[model samples]
Target chain A: MNKILKSIYMPILAVIIAIIIGSIIMLVTGFNPLAAYASLFIGAFGTLPNIANTLANAVPLIITGLGVAIAFNAGLFNIGAEGQYWIGAIVATWIGYSFKGLPWYIHIPFALIGAMVAAGLWGGIVPGFAKAYTGAHEVITTMMMSYVAIYFSHYLLEFGPMMEKGSVPQSPLIKDSAIIPTILRNTQLSYGIFIAIAAALFVYWLMYKTVWGYEMRAVGFNQRASKYAGMNVPLNIVLSLSLSGIFAGLAGAVQILGVQHRLYDSFTSGYGYTAIVVALLAKNNPIGVVFSALLFAALGTGSQYMQLNAQVPGQLADVITGLIIFFVAADKIIEVLKSMFKKQKKEELAS
Target chain B: MKEILLNPQLWSATLAMATPLALPALGGTFSERSGVVNIAMEGIMLIAAFFAVLFAHLTGSAWLGLLGAIVVGMIVAVIFAWAAVTLTADQVILGMAINIFASGFTAYLLNTIFGFSGTPTDTPMLPNINIPVIKNIPFIGQILSGNSVIVYLMIILIFASNYFLFHTNLGLRIRAVGENPEAAETAGINVIKLRYLGVALSGLFSAIGGAYLSIGLLNSFSTDMSSGRGYIALAAMIFGKWTPFGSFGAALLFGFATALSMQLQNSAMSKNIIMMLPYILTVLALVGVGGKSVSPAADGVPYTPKK
Candidate 1:
């Protein structure tokens, strides 16, 4: 229990520090930090509509974050999540647009599942080399594949048969029947939020409750030992990668069905990439993934308000995020933790 | 065959496209060879591109812009080195963070300085410098004579890098640190310093490549402009097995792939599939070179002195 507490202490403190620093910076720039933050808080959560918008953005992030978290826990850095997310969205959009007469329930699930399967296959290819070859690191492979996936998706939208002729690099819109119904009236928030939650729960169960999960964690902990212990190391690797890909794929699907409702080149901009940071921030936990996703969604969603009201560029949000990730990942934070522990011990003695 | 042999424009275009990638790939090779995975090449390039244009716009001199790129490149590289070397952070994460930072910061800078969102302050970009005697040669002149100074610098650097890697004592020490830091340490080498230098040098050269893209090539900075070329250079580094000349070959191939795509896009007949060519060729190259790529022994894993 103490060990778990120790692991989380720094991250929590970092968040506090970041908020304090952000507010100070805002104040120095001649804006009221309190008002800015108040507006930010209210803008994100003041109304049902704002909440819905926040949740809508959070849904895709949650799925993509889980995808990244799964891979990270398996000792694989799935930098290709962005690519997988793109491919997944592309596949889901393709399915949603192509199939005409299906019922909403069937069509949505079918489209989402198609996305998962497609992205899974895309991810599966990376681990194949890693498993078969003695020294293939999936990091480089995934990074390379991310580009392939992005460019491939972009090209597909550009000139492939799926592309809308005479359009500049985009796919035809899906039929209305294929769209995921929005939960709230006059909002982009869709039933996709529920799917994202279900995915988190599903992953939680898979990672914590299943035998394959045990084997996967074991393999991740020590590949040589797992191989020695008769575990199919290669199979676990491929399985983990596929599972991670599925999460990213689902993220893509949600964006199409819930938000854009069309397949467009570079549509899902940096979610896949940002999901890696989300996964890290969450410490690769499914529940943590949800909250981190929300935080990111809030930042992204809140930035528009910042841009409109404060004159701070919306890109400031990205800078803050980058700063957060940098500070969190610096690993020198270990020193900070030790100092914090020392201070706590001194306070306890004083008391 | 006769037509192919007579095509000076084709050769010039290939050289133009290839030079930018080649410089960065070679730069990346040096970094990886010294046991640091320099994925920050893209970010460095982006900053260089930004400053390259910024300085050119300010001074109206492309030479000053090129110098600015090298300076800004070093600054960013130093940041990366500080994080990866001193802080002992995960190199990959640091690289990713740098890329994200560059994108966001550049966008912010674009708005703050230029009062624009997408493109930076537009001014005259670097002009091509025509060599007197070299310009007079038939096919060779068209291919190599009149181009950016950075292109010439890249050609010179390739030979210089090759000689430095194999011929110099300091280069030998850097290679040793990469191959086996413990052994290098035993031999009285400051492994961390060497790695930092390797990475920093990579940044310097990559900046040249980036400057070439903006000032010498595009003559303008756009949002997210580096566009995975740094990552592509990383791929080339791996595909070439971390050798200066090998990466040069890989760089040429990657450049060819990109050049071919651009060529196809311009050609009236094959414009439809032009976008697909670079990606298809990249995938093919990856497959062809699968599992054959090797990094320096200590790449990505931080080197810390045992307590």
Candidate 2:
């Protein structure tokens, strides 16, 4: 219980620091940070439409973040989520546009399965290489895979046979039957949000309530010990990574099916990477991933408003988000903050 | 065949393409040898590329830009080194953060400075210097003759790095630190300082690669121009198993892939699949070489001295 409280406290504190720093930056740039924050808050919850848009952005972020979280929990750094996400979208787009589907349910599941399988293989490759071969670090391999996936996705959209012949760098629109119907009347939020929520719950169960999860977590805690305990550490590592890939692939599938309804080059637009920060801030927990995803989604979605209203570049959101991750990752900073708070409380008591 | 073999321009261009990757790979070998992963080379190169163009545009001299980028690159590398070394953060995550920060920061800098996000100033770019006697030489001369001074520097650095790593006492120390820092410290070496030096060298080499991209290759700075070359260099570093010559060979393969892809785009051949060749080759290499090599024993483990 105390550990859970600390987990919650740490992330909350990180956000407070991020906002304070963002305010200083806003002041230096001659804009009222309060006003910006107000606008951001309003933009996030202003209307049903605003809420829908925010949720729309959150869905894929949640999925991708959960994917990263699972890998991180397994002590395998899977930075290849970007590549997996791209491959997922690529595979989904191929199926959505190419395959003439029967019913909406069948078409959607087929594309989703296609995405999950593709991303899983993409994610699985690094661990397979790492486990079987030179003990090559997954971090480097995954990072490289991110580039490969990005370039491959871009090529598939533009130059491949799947390219919409008339478009410069885009794919054919998905069949109407394949589209995930929107939840709100006039927003991009769709059934994918529910899917993301379902995945979050499912993954939580897998990690905390399953035998496989126990074995994987055991490996994460101590590979040597797990090996001695008769667990196949390499297989668990590969399986965990593959599961992460599946979630990332779902992120891609949802983006196409629920939001864009068509595939374009560079469509996911660094969501996989951003999701890493989200996962870390959430402490690699599924429930935490949901709220963190929403928080980041708010920042991302609010950037559009900030851009339209103020002279500030929308990249301000990225700056704030990056700073948050940097601060959170710096455990020293958190320790310092805790000490500072303790000192302040002592001073108050003395007074 | 003789004419093709004898063409200086072909050799120079090929060598030029190979040099950028080579410099970064050589630098990477140092860090890897010291058992510190330097995947942040891509971000370092991007930062260097930005500063190189910025300083060159400000000072009207490519050399100043080169110097400026080197300085900035050192600062960026120090950030990476501090994170992985002092803070003991996850090296890969720190690297990814730096890369993301570089992309966003460069984009912001472009927007604020030049009011554009695509390409910065259309000002004067780097000029190729033609050596007097070298330009007049046969095929070898032509291949080496008309490039920037930096290309020559890279060639020298290659042999210099090879000698430094295999022959020098310091090289052995760097290798020892990577293999077992605790043991290296027991032998009276300053593991921190050596790691710092190794990371700094990584910055210097990455900056050179950045300059090559901006001043040598494209002749101007463009947004996110380093693309994924830094990652490719990381691949090369691993594919080469922390050796300068091996890394050079790996980088040449990437260069060849890139050069072929660019060439295919211009030709009437099957350009679509050709463009995908580098990434495909990257996957193949990662799978192929990733299985057979051995990395440094202490690679990616931050060395903290006994308290």
Candidate 3:
């Protein structure tokens, strides 16, 4: 219980501090902070529809956050989640459009699997191989690969086989069989949230219960020591990154199969980048990612209302998100302050 | 293909495109050489680009806009230095946050101040300086003359940076700190101060690059006008093996690829395919060259003074 509380404490405090700072920014920008924040709160949770929308927005974030968390646990920074997401969407779109007259169960699973495999191979295995065999840094390699994925997807959507009949740079709609059913009426929320939750649990089990997880953790803790202990460092690196890609790819598949139902240009909308902050805020814990994803999703969903009702720009949400990440990244500030307070209390007692 | 390769106009366009990349790539050389990985160049460029246009519009002076951008860039760099140096935070994460912050802040400010998502036209632009005798001198002149002052400055910077990194005492100290902070400290070098200086200079150079994009090459700023050039500069930095001249060459190669793509846009092939050239080339360059490049020994590691 104490451990759990300790884990939760810093993130909670970070969010509170971020909100206060955000309010100050709003006020300085000549907007009513209270009204803006209140409306934002109401817009995110005022009705069942609002709540569902927020959850729907969160599904991809949670999955991608888990992806980032897993890789970070293995001491790898997988910044290519965006690329993985794109490739997954492209593969899922191909399967969705090409297949016809198939049962829903078969087609949906096929698309999802295709997304996971293709993206895992391209975004995860290839970079992992580079890092393992050639000593390439994952940060630069993943970023470069992301551009390849992005433009490759752009080529496929705009000028390649998947191009729709119209001029719009998007794929034709997926067959109804591939669509993940909507769970809530009058909202974009779908049953994908259940899949996200299940994946979160699976990640938790994998990172904590499995032998591979133990080896990966050991390697992350100390590569030389793990190699000395007979762990295959290169293989663990590859496996860890591949696992990260799998979750990121699943996020793309869910977004396409569950929400968009087609491959569109620039569809991921920085979900991959945002996942970095989510994982960080969660301290790279899979379970914590779910809650952090929800918080961000709420902010995202409410920002539109904040724009329309309070005359604030929707980008304000992004600013707030950045602030939260900044505060969280500087979490040592909180630790230092806490230590200082303890010292002060001790002096008071002595006096 | 022969005509395209031999055309002076193509070379000129490549050089023009290369200038923006070379500036930041050179800046990154200094920062990384001092053992501070500046992944926040993208965010710095974006914020500076926005301020460049805003100041140019307000004061109607392009030079003042450039100054404003540099000041803003240095301010942002100070925050980054404080976080990465003073707080000893993870440099990569902090860099990413700053990038996101710059993007969000610029967009929000544009909305509030400009009352629109994009920069308005009628903003003053920096004038191209045509070197009189040199500009009249045939094919060489076509490639070098009649470009903005920043282009000329970029070339001068490359030579200046090479000198500063290899020949100067301060350069030796910066390299010493990057190679081994403890040794540098033992030698009585102020490692922290050198690092802060390195990072601040990087911010200054990248801001000038940003200003060039906003007012030098184009008349006004658009949302996301920098458009991944910062990342490309970083790739160039690595591909060049963290040397100023090497980075300049890499930047030129990327620029040439972009120029080739633009040349192909008029052909029967799809524009999208042509547009992928630079990005594809970047990936190939990294795959081929990345492993060969060695970074500073203590790059990206925070230095905590031993008490």
Candidate 4:
């Protein structure tokens, strides 16, 4: 119980501090903080439609956050989820549009699974192999691969095989069989939210209830010790990154089949960095990713309303997000401060 | 291919394009050599680029703009150093957060202050310097001289950095600290202080690179004007094997690839495909297509002194 509270309390404190600072910035910049925040709050959760929209927006973030959390749990800094998302999106689009006359169940499953497998292989083959074989840092290699994937998508939609024959650079719409139904009428919300939540549950099970996860976590804790204890360290590294790619690919696949319905030129997830923050906020807890992702999603949605209603730039959300990351990343300092406070209290009691 | 290779503009463009990458690549070399992984050059460069134009627009002096950028850059470096060194946070995460923060902050400021007209068109620009002696030489003069003033500054800084990192006691001590902090601490060396100095130097040079983009290469700032050059500089840092001269050479090569892509834009082959050369090459370089890249022994590992 104490351990759980220790993990939960810091993020809450960090979020509160970040919001207070954000309000201070607004006041300093001559904006009415109360009005801005009021509109922000309403825009995020005031109405049923607004809440639905927030949850809809959170679908991609939740999936990607879980993807990032998986990598984080294994002590891997996998910033290349953006690239993996791209690869999955294109693969799903290709599979979605290519096949015809198939039932919805067969077609959807086929496309989704295909995307996950290919993207998983991509994550394993490129950065994973490079890191395992040549000792290349995944940070550089994965980021480079993201550009490669993004540009590859651009090439495809612009004039390559996937381009629809129109002035706009985009792929042909997915077949009707492959399309995901809308969960809420007249809103962006889609049935993909269920998949996203399922992914979180799946991740929790995979990371906690399985033997593979145990070995992976052990390797993450101490690679040398794991190796000495007869674990295949390199395989675990490759597997951890591959699994990260799998979840990221699922985000892309679901977005394509459910939301985008087609591939467009210059297509990018744009959730790469945000998802990392979500994972960090949740402290890599799979279940906690849902709440953390929702929180960020709310900030994004509310800030847009804040921009329109209060004349405050939505970019303020990003600034606040950054401040939260600072406080969270400096968690050791928070621990130190807590210890100092505890000591002072004890001294007071003694006196 | 032969005509493109022999074209003088291509070589000069290589030099022009390389100044941005080389400066920051040199900066990365310093930061990582001191054992702090700084992926925040993109953020540093973006913030500095904006401030560079802001100051230049306000004062009508490009030099003053450069000074303002350096000051802001050093302040950011201090925060980064304090976090990565004192707080012993994850340097990579710190870098990423700062990158996101800088992007949003600059965009918000631009929207609020400039009202979306963008920076003033008449913002003062750093003058190109014509080397008097070299202008007489054919072909070589155009490639080496008569470039942006920052290009020349970058060249000088490269030579200065090469010497300082190798031939000085302070430089040796910095490397010693990065290689083994505990040993350095045991030997009466201040590990944290040296790391701060090293990271601060990165800020100084990255500021120059960012300022070069806004006032040195162009007259004003635009959103995300750094355009991933900071990451390219990281690639160059690795390709060049983390040395000043090597990074310069690698930057020139990558710059050549970029210049080549620009030249081939009018050709029949896919332009986007050609644009991907540098990125793909970056991957190849990392997978040992160029050579095996090595890092400092303690690079990216936060050092918390044993209490």
Q: Interface RMSD for candidate number 1?
A: 3.3
Report every candidate's CA lDDT.
0.79, 0.80, 0.87, 0.87
| Deviating ranges (above 4 Å) for candidate 1 | A1-5, A16-39, A131-134, A165-168, A333-351, B1-7, B58-61, B117-124, B266-291
Residues B1-307, model 2: lDDT tens digits:
3554455554566667777788888888998888788878888898898888888888888788888999999998988887777777777767776777676666666665666544445544566668788778777676767787777788788888999999999999999999999999999999988998899999999998998788767757776788777877877776776888888887777666565544545432344455455445544555554455567899888878885
Candidate 1: tens digits of C-alpha lDDT, residues A1-351: 998788777667656656776666566555677777676776678789989999998998999999888877777788888888888988998998998999888998899899999999888765545544545667766766677677677667767767887857689998888898899998779998999999899989988899888888888889899999999987888888888888899899889988888887663478988899888888898998999899989888887877777676677667667767776778586685789999999999999
DockQ of all predictions against the true structure, Cα-based: 0.40, 0.35, 0.56, 0.64
Query: Per-residue lDDT of A132-210 in model 3, one digit per residue for the tens?
Result: 8876778887887787788778678765678899878789999999999999888989999999999999999999999
lDDT tens digits by residue: candidate 4, A1-351: 999898899999989888898888888888888899899999999888889889988998899889888878877888888889898999999999999999999999998999899888877788888887887888888888877788788888776789898778789999999998888887778899999999999999989999898888888788889999999988888998899888888888998998889997764467867888999999999999999999999999999989999999888888889888888887777777889999999999999
What docking tier does model 2 reach?
acceptable
* Each model's Cα RMSD: 3.7, 3.4, 2.5, 2.5
DockQ of 1: 0.40
Rank ordering of all candidates by DockQ, starting from the highest:
4, 3, 1, 2
Give stretches of model 3 more than 4 Å off: A335-351, B2-8, B266-291
lDDT of 3 by residue, B127-223 (tens): 8889989998998888889889999999999999999999999999999988999999998999999999888988998999999999999978776
Assess candidate 2 and give its TM-score to the true structure.
0.91
| Candidate 4 CAPRI assessment class | medium
Error of 3 at A287 (Å): 0.9
lDDT of 1 by residue, B240-261 (tens): 7777787777777767666566
Model 3's DockQ?
0.56
TM-scores, one per candidate: 0.91, 0.91, 0.95, 0.95
